[model samples]
Target: MKAGYVALVGRPNVGKSTLLNHLIGQKISITSRRPQTTRHRIHGIKTTEAGQAVFVDTPGIHASQKRAMNRYLNRTAGTALLDVDVIVWIVDRPVWLAEDDLVLERIQTSAAPVILVINKVDRLEDKAALLPFLESAQQRHPFAALIPASALRGHNLDALEHKIMELLPEGEPIFDQDQLTDRSLRFLAAEIIREKLIRSLGQEVPHALSVEIEQYQTEGKLTRIAALIWVEREGQKAIVIGQQGEVLKKVGERARQDLERLTEGKVFLQLWVKVKENWSDDERALRSLGYAE
Candidate 1:
């Protein structure tokens, strides 16, 4: 009856969200090649024959010019580190260790039985070439269990699950079977919209963009949601909107399709782009956007 929490910590876009979704057997978190796709702490609960595993999916750790936001996110990430039964440090399979990778080395030594989950192994066609990367990762931290897996393709995930179960403390299920994720429907809706915008626009825009739900109501057979997508500059807004509203329309349609599936009803999604003029610097805006401590 082993049950406990496992914190998935890593640099941006190392497949932390994807690996969490895979472990939970559901899309509890969104995935994107773009870094910092996950802005908040999302809990994904997994119920198996043995026990339950609650995976805390957090924002990626990176160097931030915004020192306050960086400190906030870092503190949040560090908070998840405390009192967890295990820490799964996700790393990219193709790339070896770097100077920035030392952050994990310094922060993770205090964690109990830190496990290294080398993700995106599917990208490497040659398994032999991955050995060096794996070896280099092992040297960085004394991981309890080191496993190479592809979160997108579910490769070697069974091995990952078995190892995780073996490492967790024994107990009963913490969350109910009916509960899958900790996020509310509105929060997910906003994140879905943000995911679409990030994917469509690519790296032209910064990650300081955030979504806020303005109005949410249910009308018989449909959901009415009005949301605002806040960005830093007018140029970024134009990139998100595309030429002659085509890009914005595409983003909205894509978000709408997913929302319909999630809500199992008609979805009316209204997304408006607004420039908040140094929203990152404003502590109130940061807190409102769920980025604050």
Candidate 2:
């Protein structure tokens, strides 16, 4: 059987997390419309009769390196290129950015074959434009394959999966067939809370926010979790907490709903907003918050 690791590398907001979730038929990684939503290397394992594909969903590669968190995310995404059987380089429909070129340069150094995926084809009003774009992309590098797909609409994804499986090296399945992801429940719980915050809060709040699970316990059929939301300043904390704690309460409710759906059990979630004083720029603080590479 064919089995191997596939690294999904692309610039921010390219729908890498969305593709991974759809491919595995589950949500192994959290996603938001905001850039830099994914900060960790999440493994989503898909085992079919043909083979097992271990997909590594990484943080978006970007040009920003102002903070320790930015550097860590780049390092994590860059490191994922190594020791992989194939690389799926996703990009927005028919458009390439300077950041895409930067990501391409990094992927070129890797020995694995790369597949260029033109994601969000559903947004393409002119289907004829795809050919010229693909030709131009081909002129840039020798890609293993080029596919126009929509991760949101489930368009051509099976074809993409088939191509990935074909490129994967032959081997036995590394993970069990029933396994969907490598992340723990606690980690997913924290990510869910962060996602709620990102969706509910203002644009600037997402960059300043991080979630830490303080305590997790199971009582009979219920899972109780306490999470700490870290912000860079007192003002950010106040913004997150909102008037009469309404914002925090809404975030908690949304997170608990998602956590219940994910765990398939009742969840009792508690959230607290705390100031970390520019933790994103502080290496020690970032490490303490689990940003170490």
Candidate 3:
């Protein structure tokens, strides 16, 4: 059986996490439209009769125009591409790909073989417009395969999985076949809560907020989880909590539902909003959130 590391490198909102979830057949990572949704290297393992492929989903590559912490996210993403048996360069099929010129150039130089995965095929109403992309991928790079699949719809994922097996070098499985991700359950819980906030609260607030699971304890049929939602400003916290704390309540209820599903037990979730005063700018805060200092 073949086994090796494969990194998913691409721009923001291009379905990297979705594609990774599709490949692993599980939601090991959270996804959102906002850039930098994925800040750490999350490894999602795909096991089949043929072999095991560990897919590493990196944060989207973006020009660091926001802050030093933002640059750290990009650097963490870059680290994933440095060494791997294969690289899957995901690009949106219907949406414009020109914004990723710099990212594409970086992928082009990777020593590992690149596979152009054109995601969002299901979105393209006119399939005819994809020809240029289909043709150029093969001609432009040392691509092992140019696979078109709807990562969100689970189309052609079997083919992509098979291709990964074929390309993977002979080696031992990096992780257990039964295990889906390298992150702990606490980490998953935190990300899930963060995702709910991102979805309900919108981009401006979620980007400025960081989640921490201070207490996670099992109690009979219920799991008690206390999560801190850290924001940069008190005014932002006010918004997060919303009028009469309705917004934060909704966020907590939604997160509890998902966490229960993930943990297979009832959840007593407590959420708090606190202002860390520019946690994104402070090295200690960033480090506590798993971002590089």
Candidate 4:
């Protein structure tokens, strides 16, 4: 059996998380239109009759290291490239960007074979342009394979998966065949709350805020959860709560619905917004808030 780790690395908002979810046929990772939606390295395991692929979904590697959070994200993504059997580099568009160069530099150090995936090809207006773009990409690196796919529309993903499995080294499955992911229920609950907040709020607030589950308890068929939303400033907190607490209420309702579906039980969710004074940039604050490596 061909079983190994496949690191999905890319620039921000390039559909790496989307690709991982589609490959596993499950939503173990949260996705948003916002760049840097995935802040941690998550393992999504897919076991088939052929073998098992432990897909590592990582945060996007970007050029900006201006903020401590940005550096942390780059570090998180870069670390995922180590000792992997295969690396799948996903890009949204055909052409390369400056940020793509940043991702290229990090992956070049890896000894594993790299497969270039040009994602979002369904949105491309000129279908014929793909050939020239693929040729240009080949000149940049000796990719094991180049596949044009759309993670959103599920286009050409089977071919991509087939190629990945072929390149993986032969070994026994690293995780149990019945397992889908390597994250705890509490971690996923926090991610769900954070995803709801990101989808509901405007562009500015998503990056400045983080969700922490203060309490989680299960009683028979019901699960009670209390989550704290931390923002960098009071203004952000006010925006998250909204006028008459409507925003927080809506976020809670949406998050609870998803939590129920995930846990297969009724959820009692409580949400509160608080100011943490630039927690995203403070190293100590980040570690305390569960950003530790």
lDDT scores of the candidates, listed in order: 0.81, 0.93, 0.85, 0.94
Q: State which candidate, 1 or 3, has the greater lDDT.
A: 3
Predict model 2's lDDT versus the native.
Answer: 0.93
Off by over 4 Å in 1: 65-67, 106-109
Cα error, residue 261 of model 4, in Å, equals 0.6
Candidate 3 lDDT over residue span 144-249, tens digit each = 8988899999999888887888889997777887988888989999999999899888657877988999999988988999999999888899989999999999
For 134-206, candidate 4 gives per-residue lDDT tens digits of: 9998998899999999998899999999999999999999999999999999999999999999999998999
Give the candidate order by descending lDDT: 4, 2, 3, 1
Q: What is the TM-score of each candidate against the true structure?
A: 0.92, 0.99, 0.95, 0.99
Clashes of each: 0, 0, 0, 0
lDDT of 2 by residue, 200-241 (tens): 988898999999999999987799999999999999999999
Best lDDT among the predictions, by candidate number: 4
Model 2's C-alpha root-mean-square deviation from the true structure amounts to 0.8
The true-versus-predicted C-alpha distance at residue 200 of model 3, in Å, is: 0.6
RMSD to the true structure for each prediction, in A, is 2.0, 0.8, 1.6, 0.7
Model 4 misplaced regions, further than 4 Å = none
The C-alpha local distance difference test score for the whole of candidate 3 amounts to: 0.85
In model 4, residue pairs whose N, Cα or C atoms come closer than 3 Å (at least 3 residues apart or on different chains), thus clashing, are none
Q: Write the per-residue lDDT of candidate 1 for residues 131-197, one digit (tens) a residue.
A: 7876776786777988888988999999888888999999988889668887899889988988888
Better of 2 and 4 by lDDT: 4
